[model samples]
Target: MNIKLIVLFFSLYCLFFVASILFPIDFNWYNSLHKPSYTPSGKTIGIIWAFLYSFISLSVCIVVSMVESFKKAKWFFILFIINYIFNQLFSFFQFEQKNILLATIDCGFVSVTAILLAITAYKHSKTSFILLIPYSLWSIFATYLNYNIYLLNI
Candidate 1:
């Protein structure tokens, strides 16, 4: 395992924490909205995201570390970067901007990129691919939740 790559990937993922801080969820507004029946509690959502982020970071680290050169890691880098941006933007769209529609759209993008990232990871590192499964599944589930929220509140 590459400790440097692990640290770099994990540190990049840590920015999600910063994004959360910057776009703190407004409980009052969120609570006032009509949420779907299966919407997880905020604490549960937080816990799930924590797990997902760790797995995702580690998965990326594994894939990138296994690659002998940056050229070989280019696809992983592209997919991961796209996924990271969309992942981080969810808080900004849903919490800060308070836009259910935009957030729903963002969730779809996140899910797509996550699946792509996982598929791409499989060729380089099966461990990385397996690690990404939960993230991919969760993103799809989250997309469902977000879409329902949009429908319920619209």
Candidate 2:
């Protein structure tokens, strides 16, 4: 394993995680919202995100390490950037701005971009592609949850 590459990917994930923390979700406001009964508790959400981010970092490291061409590497980074932006924006919209509709849209973007990353990574590293499944599924679930929140709150 390339230690430097692992560090880079993990560092990038940490940056987003820290930024989300800095923005800080307003739990009071979030709790006030009309959430679905299936909505996970705050602690559960945190635990899941922690695991997902760690897996995402590992998957990205594997994909980045396996890319055989500069062009493919560039495309991978581009997709990563888009996914990162959408991931962060979901928190910004949901927690900071308290907009469930925009958050739902952001979550949708995250899900789409996540699957794209998985598909693209499939050509380079099957392990990387398989590793992304959980994140993609969780993103889809989160999108559904967010959409439901939007509907119920509307």
Flag clash pairs in model 2: none
Off by over 4 Å in 2: none
- Score each candidate by Cα lDDT: 0.88, 0.86
Q: Counting only residues 3 or more apart in sequence or on different chains, how many pairs clash (N, Cα, C under 3 Å) in candidate 2?
A: 0
Candidate 1 residue-wise lDDT, 1-154, digit = tens:
6579867777967966877888998999999999878889989999998988888877877876788997897988899988988988999999999999999899999999999999999989999999999999999999999899889887
Q: Which candidate number maximizes TM-score? A: 1
Assess every candidate by TM-score.
0.94, 0.93
Candidate 2: tens digits of C-alpha lDDT, residues 36-100: 99999999998998888888887878876777766877766789789988998887888878888
Candidate 1 residue runs with Cα over 4 Å from true position: none
- The most accurate candidate by lDDT is 1
